[model samples]
Structures are given as structure tokens and as C-alpha cells.
Target: MDQKIPYDDYQLPVVFLPSYESPPAWIPPQERIQHPDYNNELTQFLPRTVVLKKPPGAQLGFNIRGGKASQLGIFISKVVPDSDAHRAGLQEGDQVLSVNEVDFQDIEHSRAVEILKSAREILMRVRFFPYNYQRQKERTVH
Candidate 1:
């Protein structure tokens, strides 16, 4: 036992080990099912402003679903191919942060839709965290 004690003293303590890496980047709760990048190099979750000019009686060509009315967030459920929204880079799983310079975070879903429908020129600021394409398709199916 005496001889073994000398060897034990040479071992490094746990604290001497390399520091723990930070926890994997957090993906928002709504985007959990969709795999978000651990490190967003280019975008970094910044809000992007997209401007769309739709002629009278034209659709914006995107579908949106509102989050809790009190919370103020909405999901872009779909973007029609070759539509104005499509050309504008609107993607499924993008979160709509505001419309027309007005924050929609706390607005009711129907009210937000109404605002969108009523506007001829739309200015939208959105956060896009691209999820897995396959997973997004699955969510749409069922």
C-alpha cells in the first residue's frame, strides 16, 4: 500500500483537464424537431428584411400560421413555388418577426393575416433557421 501511494500522487486532478465545451447552440422550441446548425456562421439568426410588391388583388404566395397571440411570433408554413414570396427567399420554417415595420409578436393570428391581406406593399422581417429538408417535408405530410 505504501508503494502504491507514491504513484497515485502523480495523477492529475479532474480540474486540470481541459475545460468543458459550451453546450450545443440552442435551437428555438418551435424548431426543435428541425435540426438547426450548432454554429450559424453567416446568418447568426439575424432578422432579414424582405420587401414584396404585389399588384392589386394578388396573393403574397406564402402561408403563415400564428403562434400564441400573447407571444408575438408566426411561422411561415409554406411558400408557393415561383411566387413573389418564393422569389423573395421566404422558406418554410422561417419565423415572421414583423410585417410593415410593425412587430407582430403579440398580434392575434387572424389579425396578422388580415394585416397581410390588406397591404399592397409588404415589408417583412423574418428569422430563418433552415431545418432539415426531409424533416420539413415530413412535418407537412402528417
Candidate 2:
């Protein structure tokens, strides 16, 4: 149990800064946002496509690998000593491109992973984005 004592007076600061009479005219205009080519470069792998760096213990594991980010490929998180993944030519750094001849980005996370596990053998394609020659040339000149 605790005894209560009440004898307090409080006052907050009410200072006000001088208001701007007029804004300056030199502000630069904002740029228009560009849309991403999700269908081309960003092929969704799976909901669990994000492989944690290490095994999840009692505490929650997984980080914002650039959060909500659609990555280019599937990065291998772990290599089980004796597992089907390891047995089926899946390496630690393998990138999954397509499953059953269909791109993953076309499907949502839940559907993609379910299709993968249930089917036992996923017909995944591995594709890579060609280097951007224009961007490379610009960087070289700069």
C-alpha cells in the first residue's frame, strides 16, 4: 500500500516564434516517382523466401533485409547437413527463379510456398538480370 500526497502546481512554456510573412521562391520542385519493373527483375520467391542468417532460437529471428523489399533472387540462408534441399542440388547460395515454369512474383506469398512444399519437387528456374550497360557507362564517365 502507498500513501498519496497532493501539493503541486505546474506551468508549461507558452512561447511563440515569429511567423514567416512570406515563403522564399527558391525551393526546388519535387521529382515524380517512377514505378518498379516487378514483373521483370523482382520475381517473388516465397513467403519464407527470406532465409534468416541463423536458426531461430527461443527468441524471434529475422531482420528487415531492406524491409518489404522485393529481391532479385533467392538467397540461401542455411545448408542442412542431411536434408532434401541439400540432397536435391540446392546449395547455400542458390537463387530460385521460377517454379513449374511460372514466375513467383505473379503469385502471392502464401500460394507460392504452399505450391513448393506440397509438390515435393518444385520445377524452379534460375534467371539473372543482365548488367545495365547504360548505367555503367554513365558511372564510368562521371
Candidate 3:
């Protein structure tokens, strides 16, 4: 690692130019681009409900990973191709907020899995935060 030289040892002239004009007015939260549902119209609508009807003895067709029990909620890590979950439009990175109308916001991972496994038909509510892989790759490449 390169050593950082302290600027205090150098004798540099200080330039102080004060601005006369006032700062710009603070924009409302709804008018800002970062605010949800404000300037984001092209993205997918979040808090979407996906209904998956699983036949008897059939699998849910999705893999879940991450999130600590009773802490952070689990995520849909993978959605099997041509599966029930995929057919129902479940995407990766969907934060599983609830299962069968029961909120699992602070639910344990094992308990959440139990709840999901026990249900024949699942009514899952998910928050969709879009991820652009191509854009991310381009940024990383540069």
C-alpha cells in the first residue's frame, strides 16, 4: 500500500470564495427519482402477488436461500424453468414477505420453509426490486 502524505506539512495559499446566491430548494420526496412510485414508471410494479397451484406430491419448483431466522426474510434464489413458480411469474431476488397471507417478516428460515412445504397452494406476496445484469456487467467491465 502507498503511504499517504499529510497536507499539513505543505504551505498552500487558502482560497475562500463565498457564494452570494442561496441554495436550491429541496424537492418533495414524491418528485424525486429515487422515491418509489414517483418517477419510476417503466419498472415492474412491486408488492405483486403470485399464486402458485401445486399438484399433490408436486414440488414448489423454487429454491430459497439467505436471510437469518427471525431476522431478515428469505429470498427466492432460483426459480426452476417451466415450473409452477416460474409459470406464475416468480423472479429471482424477490423478498418473500408473506406466505399464505401470514406475514413472515421476522420468521425463522426453517419455520418459513415448513409453512411453505405444508401448503398445497401458495399465495406469495413479493416485493420486486429490479436488477439489470447487463448494465451491471458493463459498469464492472469498465
Candidate 4:
């Protein structure tokens, strides 16, 4: 004789499973997201405004290079330590976009230098774009 077990008498182990909602099909995968910081673009550069006040007969404490002659924008070549420029967050290789509202994008190297030296209070808009500067240097060298 065969014995049959009752369904109600059987014990089932309790299970707790984590549930995840699937992302919408319209949404792109996270792997597709573009990381902009890895690329070189004007937007990636850090733009800043630096104000330097020159004391009577005192130097601005930074040297600039590049301009129309070089087919490049004005770039800070040197920044004297503990000087007004350095203290104002100026660094070597920074491109000067403007000075006291005057555009430096296409100014001559000599004119740019003269403006920087003659100003009592220099307000400059600059950005750190070493990548472009390096590319320009390479082009000029070749």
C-alpha cells in the first residue's frame, strides 16, 4: 500500500529575494556616458579673473609670452614667487584672455607686455590651457 502526504502538512522554506527595477529601454546605458574631463576643450579649461595692484615703481611679478607674432594667445611664461601675480593665483602657462576689458586674443607680444607693465591695477581674465599652448608650441617648432 502506497502512502500519500497531505499538501497542508508539507513545510516550505521561506525565501527572501531582492527585487530590482529595470531601467527604461529609452535610457542609454551608463557605459555610454561621455566623460568630458578626459578631452581637451575650451570648456574644460579653468577660467579665472586675476587682479593685481602694482605698488609705486614695483613690478607686476609675472612675465608673458606669445601673441600675434607667434600665432598664439598671450600666455604667462613666469610667475615670481610671493609677488602680486603669484599671490593673485597667476601661474605659468596660463593664457590671458583679456586685460582691463581689453582683448588680448590677437594683440602683439610687445603691446601685451607694455600693457601689463604700464598698468597700475591690472584686471585680467585668464584660463589654464596648457594643452593648447603645447600644441601651438609644437606647430611653431615644426
Candidate 5:
């Protein structure tokens, strides 16, 4: 006759398995979990290209902050309502990745301002990153 084991007295066997798995070789380094720049949060806000034409003697109607002085990447500080930038989908707190194919990710404030002002037709690659922008702003303020 088999005796029934009490539920409280029963023991479960512990199994040990490898916790890490190598990612596929085809995956790009940036997309890999182990990459330094890998950030799952950023995937949700994919970079988008915004094309705008500046009317003669007219401002783009947007303000930009960040750069070497701020120790932050270029970010849109403001976007005027019904402006060219606003109509083109540019929003405040959006990070500017590049302008006219020129990397704005790491640039000087004056240089960035010059680039934006000099270009009549702008092609910018940007992504919404309000959290980062806010943190950077706070850091610069203090």
C-alpha cells in the first residue's frame, strides 16, 4: 500500500539552468541587449524625419537647447503654435538627432544655432524624449 505524503512535508526538486543566452549574430549591436547604447524605452519613440521650408526672413518658430554648454544633446525647447515647425510635427522636448544629415547629437550650442539658422530647408531627424530633456534641463539649471 502506498502512503500519501502530507502537502506540507512534500519537497520540490530545484533545477539549475543557464540564465544567459547569446543573441543571434544577425542582430545589430545597437539592437542587442548587451550593447552600451541599447535602450528598450527608446524603441517606443522611433526617430522620424521632419522636412520644413523656411520662408524668406521668417523664423522656423522653434527654440533649441542643449549642446556642449548644457552637456546634453540637442533638444527642441519650444515649438510655436501654428508655426512651420509645429505643423511639421516638431514638438517641445523632442531630441534632435541630426539636421540636414549633419550629426547634431554632439555639437556646440553656437554651432547648432548657426546650422539651424543658415539652412532655409531643413531635414531633421528627431525623436520624442521629454524625460531625458527634462533631466538634462534640471542638471544644467543647478
Candidate 6:
């Protein structure tokens, strides 16, 4: 009706099909796993690097609520006055989102702990992206 009822306005379109070739079953499939370390800020970190005294019956955890409620995760927690993390540019309340270019959000906490504890003197790829605690919040103070 919007086109003034014109019969020449359109036509049925033609379709084309391509040939298919199947791969041999012997060929191994490529890996589908993501990097397993791509950290997303809204997620809780496994705290894989620390050997801290956890609460009774508690496991290693990142302080997800230790900062401004809106920017809750922007701050790193309890970096030692002069520890490896402190030396490695980790500051108290510095939002942590990565270790060696891998995000904490990409893997399970157990796997992350193993990766962090495998070696005491390893360099990790780290990224610092603003994270929202919940999907509803996105405004950043910085």
C-alpha cells in the first residue's frame, strides 16, 4: 500500500548452489578452545597467584566488592608492600583483568590457580580494561 500498489516493484530472485567437498575423516579437527585466559572484568578472578590465609572453608578469591560499588573491581587488593606482584606493577586496588595477556574470565578457578602456581618466576600477559560489576552498570569514573 505504501508503494501505490505497483505490480512492477519487485520480482522473484534467482538462487545459486555451490558444490560441496567433504574432508577425510582421518584429518584431526582444529582446536575450538578459546585462549582460556581472556579476562572479562565483570567476572570474578581465581586469585591464582597468592598463598594467602583464606577464610575457614573458603577458597582463594578476588575481592570483587572491595572498592567503589560502581567501580568495585577497578582496584587491586592487598598488594604486599614489597612483593613480586608489587614489583610487577601490581598496586593495591588496581583493577586486575589479566595475567600474561590472558583474561581470568576465560578459565576455571582451579586451572587458573595451577597456572599461577606452576612457577614463581614467570612473566604473564596482562590487560587493564575497565570492568563493570554487573551488566546494568557501564559508566566509568576514570
TM-score of each: 0.60, 0.34, 0.59, 0.65, 0.66, 0.32
Is 2 or 5 the stronger prediction by TM-score?
5
Per residue, candidate 1 scores C-alpha lDDT tens digits across 1-142 of: 4453554577665234676899877678777655555343657467899999988889889987654542435778789999989998999878788899877776667888888999999999988755533344444421
TM-score-best of 2 and 3: 3
Per-residue lDDT of model 2, residues 68-137, tens digit only: 1233333333446555455544444344445666565344444554545545334555332233222222
Number of the top TM-score candidate: 5
lDDT minimum window of 10 residues, candidate 6: 59-68
> On lDDT, who's better, 1 or 3?
1
The parts of candidate 5 lying over 4 Å away from their true place are 1-44
Q: Tell me the tens digit of each residue's lDDT in model 3 across 86-126.
A: 98888876777788988867666677888888898899998
Which runs of model 1 end up more than 4 angstroms from their true locations?
1-44, 69-72, 129-142
lDDT scores of the candidates, listed in order: 0.74, 0.37, 0.70, 0.80, 0.85, 0.41
Deviation (Å) of 79 in candidate 5: 0.4
Q: Sort by TM-score, best first.
A: 5, 4, 1, 3, 2, 6
Provide the lowest-lDDT 10-residue window in model 2: 59-68
Model 2 TM-score relative to the real fold:
0.34
Best-fitting candidate, scored by lDDT = 5
Cα error, residue 83 of model 1, in Å, equals 0.7
Which model, 4 or 6, shows the larger TM-score?
A: 4
Distance from true position, residue 1, model 5, in Å? 64
Q: Rank the models by lDDT, top first.
A: 5, 4, 1, 3, 6, 2
